[model samples]
Target chain A: MLKIMIIGATSVIAQETARFFATEGAEFFLVGIPADKLVVIKDDLVARGAKRAEVYEADLTDFDKHPQIIESAVQAMGSIDAVLIAHGTLGNQKAAEASVEVALKEINLNLLSNISLLTLLGNYFEKQRRGCIAVISSVAGDRGRGSNYVYGTAKAGTTTFMQGLRSRLAKSGVAVVTIKPGLVDTPMTADIKKNFLFSDPATVGKAIYLGMKKGKDTVYAPWFWRYIMAIIIHIPEFIFKKMSL
Target chain B: MTTPLNRLKQYKSWGRYPTVEHKAIHQIHWRSDLPDVNQFEETVLPYGYGRSYGDSCLNEGGILLDTSYMQQFIAFDAEQGLVRCEAGVSLEQILEVIVPCGWFLPVTPGTKFVSIGGAIANDVHGKNHHRAGTFGCHVTQFELVRSDGTYICSPTENAELFRATIGGLGLTGIITWAEFKLKRIPSPLIDQEKIRFANLDEFFAISAEMDQRFEYLMSWSDCLSGGDSMGRGIFMAGNFYDPPLGAEPSAKKLKPFVPFDLPSIALNTLSVKAFNAVLYRVPLGKRVRSIVHYEPFYYPLDAINNWYRLYGKRGFLQYQLVVPLEGDNEPIREVYRRIAQSGEGSFLVVLKAFGDIASPGMLSFPMPGVTLALDFAFNGEKTLKLLDELDTIVREARGRVYPAKDARMSPENFRAYYPQWEAFAHYIDPKFSSSFWRRVTASAKSANGQ
Candidate 1:
């Protein structure tokens, strides 16, 4: 059984991804906010056939608590075979644009918090000589737009950081996976307008699970989003600015 | 409420009739932050995949709590065949998780797309009703979140609320989570047999014998066969059968799909009658006995994805009525006679007998009798008049129409059919309501002027 540590275990996507592994009788160390929700996830994973499920509640944005969280997860699981960072939010775009404080807070929660956990897990996996690291980035990071550049910038940073970490970790036989999903219908994106393009959380969860298992460097949730993003990235800046995407 | 495309036509029931606009809709993802009915203007109803055939799934000028995303299995016991899951989890999802574990739903409706909450709220029955009873029969317990407070309900605890909420149609409260027993299956395949019956008498005779031998029994009646030849149909019987040693469940083959709505003229009287006539004869050539997958045997219409589109843009209403065997069976014949005279025969008509197994729910549909269900394509006032006529026949015979399949049953008829509705209304949450509830109880509300 794989010993996996998942931050943001309360996320619908994260819970589904964890469930995919649970069927295989994997062990888990879950860390997320709201201790009560985390307890539900722990029970769910155990019921789904997980060998063991231990939870730690902590606000991931607190940089000071990063070390303590990582240390506790390691002590709980004994050894980590894989790690998935699957928590973030789409904060109010209008608020972020009007205030620099709002923009930085979202950036810190979405980008800095993940980078801090990766920093600790990266070192641990590197010295251990074998493991996998996965993070749920988004296609919004592929290019910036007026609608949500603040959230985009944060995801873009994490996506680039994973790229750099993959090269460094490869020498020690560690694998790093960066998952980039398009619009997903979840509580996080509940307020956003959705269409045929918005995939359900369950489908995206299975994709994330498969991408992590294959240890892919960059993966798209619906697979078609890969080609869709490829076409969008080629649009000229002058024409793109005029189009109200 | 989310997409521009979906915003154009808010939401619809399975029948796609009496389309109503809701003031707002909230998508629930987790059980913790469930939407409170008091927060929204007008009435509120929990909507799950919109499987109710008529107005029961709708709440016009009100709010809808769409709980399709609140799907998560809370607990599972493969050995004990007991599983618990969030309310929005569909029967299809449960089947996927448990079928591999050699277990199956104790009772499943025609389609696997219906959510667990919707199943209990409607008290849906299956082909095995003669054996296993309604879906609510196996439910051990569930958490009901009402405006007043949350209540843990079961047969032994909060028993009154439990009975009321089973077929209460989402007015009692929003079910957060539910736990039920699963049927232990030796294999996923079923030993099925089909025999032709010439008339209603033959069909009933065959059913009586089949009920004693098979766990699943159902029939397909040709609605066009009127006069002395009326009710000619095929009887089907099935029992769980083990597969050959070392056989594995095969990957699902691609199914036929109805991608878009067909023109309203596609199912005209002549074409529908011809199709039904052809369908009856085709089965005669096939082998009488075969080992088949349970999914196909239980849900043949689901073979085509979105088969509802076949009814066309105008939509169709499923007319389902049941009467006890203690009364004269002539009411059903008169009902079918009216449909034939109207020249609005549907392509598919089903008949089945409900056994003596009593349901725990107060307003559950089935009893010690048989039910007949058929789809009537919406054709303005003419179709409505025909339905009203049939309702009178069924009402006078001491039978009742199914609320889930009804769009326009008269308030007086509903009052007479379920005399317990007056007492049952007391348990309804003050802030929860549905279009069907309001339509059926209009007289009651106005007479009391409360």
Candidate 2:
């Protein structure tokens, strides 16, 4: 069984990813904010055929506690085969635009905190020389949107960080997969009007799991997002600036 | 305190009738995330796939623990044919993996979209029920987490909780995970045969004769048929047949889905009657024997994805009831006559017989009887009154209505049919409550002082 650590165990996508691993009888060390929900997820993971489902409650934004969380997971599982960083917030863009404080906090939560965790996990996986690290970015990261530019900017920075990390870890055999998903129908996006463009979390979850397993460097979830983003990226700055996307 | 992820939303059961707004729709993606059962003052119910045809899956103003995110397959023993999985793992998901390994669900409901937890809570029965019994019978054990503590229950361990949780309608507590045995099949194909039955008597006669021979048997009756033509329908029976190739055919990745809800007038009695008449003649006109894939054989409605949309935005209710196989089929005949006389002809009227096998669930709907299920478009009071009249006939015959398929069964009759309600009620964790439970028990307390 693959020994895996999920940073945000309760997020819809993370839960879906955990399920994908559970089907393979992976051993999971789950970390989420709510203790009660973590226990519930652990129980569910165990039932879904996980070899072991150990849980720890810690706010992902608490940068100081990152190393200890990883230490605890390593201690519990003895070793780790994969680390899936699926914790991020779709911070309210209107608030971020209105206040510098909100923008800074959103950046800290979405990017800085993730970078801190990755730095620690990257070092650990480099030393181990055999593991996979997957992070969920967003299609918004491909090009900033006026509606969610704050979240998009953080994701863009994280995606670039992953690209560099992928290059750094290329020779070490540690896979760094950057997943960019389009309009996933998670609770974060529940209020967003659902349409044909939206993807189910389970489907995205499967894609993330498979992309990591296949050791793909960077992938757009559902495959279609890659083409959609490609088209958006090619738009002239003048046209893109004028368009309200 | 409520979690940050909590949100309020409108919820509806599969029937789409009686939609209600939930104040706290907290989705528990993990067992540990659940609040201590005692912490919540408001009513609560674990909602899994919301596949129940009625209010059993609804909580109204109460909190709904959405379990869809908790789906996972925990363990699978190919040698023993046992699969342990989280309560939220769907039948469709299970089939995708297990069917390839030559294992099939021991019991399955009509729709595969339902979660394992919902199936057990409802003690759903399938065409194979005559031989395999309800879904609860095959479940070896399950873990139920309540407000006080968590309990691991099985037939030999915490057996009372085990019995209570099955067909318990999520009131016993939240079922986290369950282990059950799987039936093995040589291939995904079934050797199927369809026979035309002119009346209800022929349905009974043919069912009795074929019960032992076929592993799965069910019939579709013409709901509008009355008098000399009453109960005219088609009878279908099947046994697993080895595929020409050794492998069970892999299912398609994409299935066609209904785009949107049709108008309420889209499916009226006239349309249903015409469709039923056409269906009645199709089998009768030909020699109906074929080796077919199990997908259509087991789940015909599944072929038309989101077919419930056909019922319209107002939604529809399926009134499925069972009467004991006593007194020369008079009770079942009366039921058909009343439905026809009411002019609420349902296109999806199914008739089947349950064998002598009894399920372990205290509130399980299956018994040694004949069950008739019909789909009726929601027409407010008119539909409810029709169901009430049907309930009277069922009560008179000492038969029971399926809570999973019933939105409005009288509390007095619920208690009478399920005398074990008092016993089952004792095991219900105070933290867990549902619209069905509240409606039934409140009325039971007022009407009969139970």
What is the per-residue lDDT of model 2 for residues B8-60, given as tens digits with 9 covering 90 to 100?
Answer: 22457878877878877666655545666566678789987777878888887
After superposing all C-alphas onto the true structure, candidate 1 shows an RMSD in angstroms of 3.8
Please, what are the lDDT tens digits per residue for candidate 1 over residues A150-231?
9999999999999999999999999999999898777787777777788866778888888888888888998999999999
Total backbone clashes of model 1? 0
Task: Give me the displacement of residue A58 in model 2, in angstroms.
Answer: 12
Choose the strongest candidate by DockQ: 1
DockQ of each: 0.36, 0.20
Error of 1 at B411 (Å): 0.6
lDDT of 1 by residue, B100-132 (tens): 789989999998888899999999999999899
lDDT score for residue B201 of model 1: 74
**Candidate 1 C-alpha error for residue B145, in Å:** 1.5
Q: What is the lDDT, from 0 to 100, of the residue A194 in candidate 2? A: 60
